[model samples]
Target: MTFLETLLDPFQYQFFIKGLVAALLAGGLCGLIGVFITLRGMSYIGHGLSHAIFGGYAAAPLLGIPIVLGAGLWGLASALAINAVTRRHRIGADAAIGVVTTASFALGVALLTKFGNKGPAFDSLLFGSINGVSIGDLLLLGGVFLGTIAIFTVLYRQLLFSTFDPEVAKVSGVNVGLMDTILMVVLSMSILATLSIIGVTLVAATLVIPPVVARMLTDSFGRMLWIATALGTAAGAVGMYLSYQLEIPSGTTIVLVNAAVFLVVLLLKGAKGLGRTAGLDDHTDASATGLVTASAPTRA
Candidate 1:
């Protein structure tokens, strides 16, 4: 069936509709923040936050709290802890990520013993069942996505500058540290928003893969972000289809589909670049560097 026909011939399945909505919101948010994640070469942080979200997820059942809210706080705390440790102790981002995320997640798992009889549902945080998604989840996703876009509108130039060249950004009067911290919070929040739809485990793929794909196609950072957002949305929708037909987890299916697309686009674009640079062995040394370059964005 055509795309229009498939969507129009709805089975009146409210759950299916919910799943689609969830994917769209989650995918869009991940794609947007992913622009920064990719530019900064900090894909590992996204991976760490995705898993660290389990801290909040584990807290919900025991403390009689909402998992998303708990996870958001968990993510924020994890980000701060990582930043502090890395700053004060001369630890790196990767090492800090391992220490904070694993520790927080382990604590969450350990605290489960106190809430006897009210066993925490495993899938609530790990493997999201689309049917369990409520209207509140949709609202939270919408709020985060819109808020992120608004913030980006105001700070895009600064973020782009800092991501491309922290030293220049600092010298040029941009608040690189403050911008970095705020972006970290936004990223942690984005990961939390997507955790319900993509699950804590699969969020890294949704965030990193889309931007990675976009980077191959565009030389300009702003254009790359928009392209990444589009790719993410497409992957999200296709993932929903994969989940429905395969009788599998929607979030996992979505993430896997995204990964496949990323691989395909990367190879395709890389080949195209090589083909163009084939004969220019000495003359077009610039083009041989391919599309990726370190020309920093200018701050406003």
Candidate 2:
């Protein structure tokens, strides 16, 4: 087969096409939210919340409820609980996260062991089954993507201010507490949307790795968001294609691809730093003069 034929092979099947769309949407949305997650150093929240929501998954089938609905509610409640506990009790954020999330996960495991029967397999829930995405899932993802864009568009300034400088934002009447709540809610929604695509085990990586990679590539937040989204989409698409070709698990392949990209960027950054050091060594006198000039003060 030719290159184009090989590339287009997966598109011939409806499930593959759906998986492609689902992967891209999941990756892009996670990447978008990941910027804030990274900036606020709340990456653990993603992991914690993902695990916490597993309780809903464990209980849903036994209760004759939709798994996504149950999981989403649990995830949202977890986010709110974390926020409330850390704010009200003066607990460390990490400690709050660890306590609540682990408890939720433990509850889930217990519930599943006791009540789960011939429902969705734990493997699919934990590891993901992107190729199993349905049309309804696609619609849900689309709604989430649009909702995310709308929220960010409407609250960009407040969100940015709160994220980088909460004290200043609060002094400026930005409602830092409300902003935090909003961010947490949005994060919960993002996590819910990503659960099926990447599954609970690996969804947090999707929410983190892309932004970290983008941070390595740029200093501008705007550029960081765009770069991260693009990198995530690219990783998902490429990973999906690679998984199809190799018959590997899509979620694992996607994460591996993301990690591979991160490693490449790290190497490039290191090389660039080395090159700058070499250039500085070659231009020691010029560098000293420039440094002195840069440090000089001017009188108005």
Candidate 3:
């Protein structure tokens, strides 16, 4: 069917609409938070948090509580825990993430096994099956996305300053520590957004891959957010479709597609950089900018 035909298709259901809304909201939030994650060089931290939350997910089904809520709470706690340990010691953030997430998730598995042997259901949380999403899940996802956006908007200048130049932000009284804590919280929420919807294994990719691809396409952070969001939305939808039509796993297929997109971007960017040195595509990038102009955000 054509684009118009598809829109008019009666096969369109509320579930599909909800899924799309969830994906868009999740994608935008991830793209925004990912800028900080990518900039801070903490992709592994994102991975650790997503995995650590599995313990909560395992407990949720047995307790009959909100799975996302359970996971988000634990994820946030993990984030704060990482921040605390990394701050008071020589252990870098990455090392802290490695230690905490793996241990917590392992403990979660052991505890879950002891509870009622409900391990397979817990596996679904890790693998993700959007086919099972409900209205409640959509609402929860939306709430997290909006709350994160509002918090970031309120601290826009301070966060940006702290991210780019923490010492200067501290000297200028920007509350750098608070911003760091908030950013980590947002990052945890981003993982929660995708944990059950896209599964834990792919959650980090949904946050990192699109942003990494978006980076090569533009230099401006603003533009990068837009491009990454677009890529994320596309990846989610197309990946789901391929999974359905091909009868493959939806979450894994989408993640693989997103990874492929990232590989392509890396190759293109790498070739360009190599060409620049080899004088193949040797030329100045007119797109480079010293600051954000009104037109500068077009790519984002």
Candidate 4:
């Protein structure tokens, strides 16, 4: 077969089409949210929340609940719990994340051990199954993507202010707490929606890698958002095609693609320069146009 014929072979399968669209939506969504996550130093939240939501994934079927609603609610509650724990206690955000997510993941493992795997295939949930993605999954992904864009549009300034300087944002009457909650809720939605395609094990890579690469490429927050989104969307589509060609796990392949991009960006930017750019540094332009120059405050 010629190169074009070989590449076009997968299009004959409906599952491939669904999976590809799901991946594209997931990648772009993660990229958009990842900017906030990395900027606020909440990178671990993506990792932690994905694990925490696994408990819900394991439980929803047993309890006769819809996977989307059940697991999504569980993820949201866990996120809120982490936020509350951090605020009300002396424990740091990292510590709270470790505690909450580990316990939740443990619950998942325990349930699986006691009751056996139910709902979906055991391996597919952990490692992802592109062929398993259904029409419903695609709809959920699209909905979450649009919802995230709407939220970001309506609260752009508020989120930006709270992200860089929560204290100042609060003093300026930005309702920093509400902004935090909004972000957590949207993040929960994003993770829950993308869980099926990226799987629990590899989702965090999609969230972190794209934004980090974007940061290395640009100093402007607005540009970072666009660059990250574009990279993620491209990674998703390209990774899907590559996974089909290579006969590998889709989620793993997608993550490897992101990692490869990260490496290339690191090499191009140079180690010293990447270090300088990737680290949270003060920008010179702190304007309403989404160019933030202030050093972001540590979130707990």
Candidate 5:
């Protein structure tokens, strides 16, 4: 096949087309929410919620219900429970995440074992295959992508204020508590949105690595959002293509691509820093800003 034919070959198939759309939507949405996730230091929350959703997935089949709905509810409940536990008690957020997530995951594993072959295959749920995406899945992913954009657009200022400066935002009447809840809700839904495309095991990486890489490249939040989204979208498309050609797992390929990108950016950033240290790049600007620091007040 010619180079152009090789590139266009995947697009000739309906399943491949649907998979690409799903990947782009899931990746972009994850990238958008990931900015806030990274800034707020809630990476663990993403991982925890993804695992917690497995509980609902394992139970939904037994109840004759849709797995997505069950998993979404479970993910949301986990997010809220973690928020409530950390806020109402003296315990740290990570501790609450550990307690809630592990228990939920264990329940999922036990249920799966008890009802072997009744539910969807454990391998499919844990490590997704993008080629399995259907029209219905594409529609759901589109709805989620649109909804996320609307929410982010309407609440941009409040969300940004609360994320970077919660105390100041509260003083300015931003309703820090409510904003935090909103963030959690969005985070939960984002995890659910990516479940079918990336699965529980690797979804959190999609929600994290892109934003971290974007953060290394830019100081401005707006730029970071754009860069992250672009990076994620590109990674998803490229990874899917590579996976198809290489006959590898889609979720694993996508995550590995994301990680590779992050590593490359990290090395580049380190190199730049070293150049600055050696006074080899006097024209280099100062490090980017807007990332959360240890001194910043964080909401549990």
Candidate 6:
């Protein structure tokens, strides 16, 4: 077969097309939301929420609820509970995530052991496969992707303020708590939408890798967002094609592609790039001022 024929072969299958679209949507969505996630130092939240939602996935059938609805609600509740615990108890967010998510995941395991894989397919949910994606899953992923774009566009200033300097944002009447809650909600929704395509185990890698690579490439937050989104979109499309050609798990292929990109960027940029990106947390407020634009309070 010619090169073009090779590229076009996968298009013959409707399933491949659906899976590609789903992968593209899920990857880009994770990239967009992941900026705020990493900036706020809550990188673990994606992993945590994914595990927590698994509990709901297991319990939904027993409760006679649809898996999507039950798992979504459970993920949202877990996000809120983590937020509440961190704020009210004066403990570390890491500790709160560990305690809550592990317990929820343990519940999922117990349920699976006792009841069986009564929710979705066990291997698919854990490792991911494009063959299992349905029309409903595509619609859900597309809807969530569009919703995320709208949220980020509308709340740009507030999100930037709260992410970099929550105390300052609150003092400037930006409603830091509300912003955090909004992020948590979006995050839960993102994880729930992506679980099937990316799998619970690898979802966090999709969320973290693109943004981290973008951060290494740029100091400006605006540029990072654009770069990360582009990288993530490309990774998804390319990874999906590669997975089909190689006959590997789609989720594993996507994550491996991301990791490969990260290594390539690291090698090209060297230690200086890594060190500079590492220090962003310290200078994020001052360095990222240009991101929030004129709408941001001058006081901030």
Q: Which stretches of candidate 3 lie over 4 Å from their true place?
A: 1-17, 61-65, 117-120, 273-300
User: Residues 1-300, candidate 2, lDDT per residue (tens digit)?
Assistant: 999998788889988888889889988988999888877778889999988988877877778789778877888899999999988997988899999999999999998777664455677667667566888778888898899889988888777766766665676677879988988988888877777778788888988889888766755667778988998899888877777888876778889999999888878897653343232212232433343334332233
Q: After superposition, how far is residue 92 of candidate 5 from its true place, in Å?
A: 0.9
Instruction: List CA RMSD, all candidates.
Output: 5.1, 7.4, 6.1, 3.6, 5.4, 1.8
By lDDT, the best candidate is 6
Q: Candidate 6's residue-wise lDDT over 58-146, tens digit each?
A: 98988899999999999999999999999999789999999999899999989999988877898788867889889999988888888
Stretches of model 5 off by over 4 angstroms after superposition: 1-4, 271-300
- What's each prediction's TM-score? 0.85, 0.87, 0.82, 0.93, 0.88, 0.95
In model 5, the number of clashes is 0
lDDT of 3 at 152: 70
Against the reference, the lDDT scores of all candidates come to: 0.74, 0.79, 0.70, 0.85, 0.79, 0.87
Ranking of all predicted structures according to TM-score, beginning with the best and ending with the worst: 6, 4, 5, 2, 1, 3
- Residue 154, candidate 5: C-alpha displacement in angstroms: 0.9
Q: Estimate, for each residue in 1-300, the C-alpha lDDT of model 3 and write its tens digit.
A: 798775445237665556556655665666667766765667678778988888777776677777677777888999999999988899998899999999888977877768864533555567666465678767777887788778877876676656655665577666778888999888887787766557777777777778777767776656766787788878887766555556555568778888888777778789653332221122122332233122221211
Q: Which scores greater on lDDT, model 4 or model 6?
A: 6
For candidate 5, list the clashing residue pairs, or say none.
none
C-alpha RMSD in Å of predicted model 3 compared with the true structure: 6.1
Largest TM-score belongs to which candidate?
Answer: 6
Instruction: Name the 10 consecutive residues with the lowest summed lDDT in model 5.
Output: 279-288
The sequence of per-residue lDDT tens digits that candidate 4 reaches over residues 80-175 is 999989888999989999999999999998999999888777777787778789989999999999999999988988898888877777776778
Model 1: number of backbone collisions: 0
Clashing pairs in 6: none
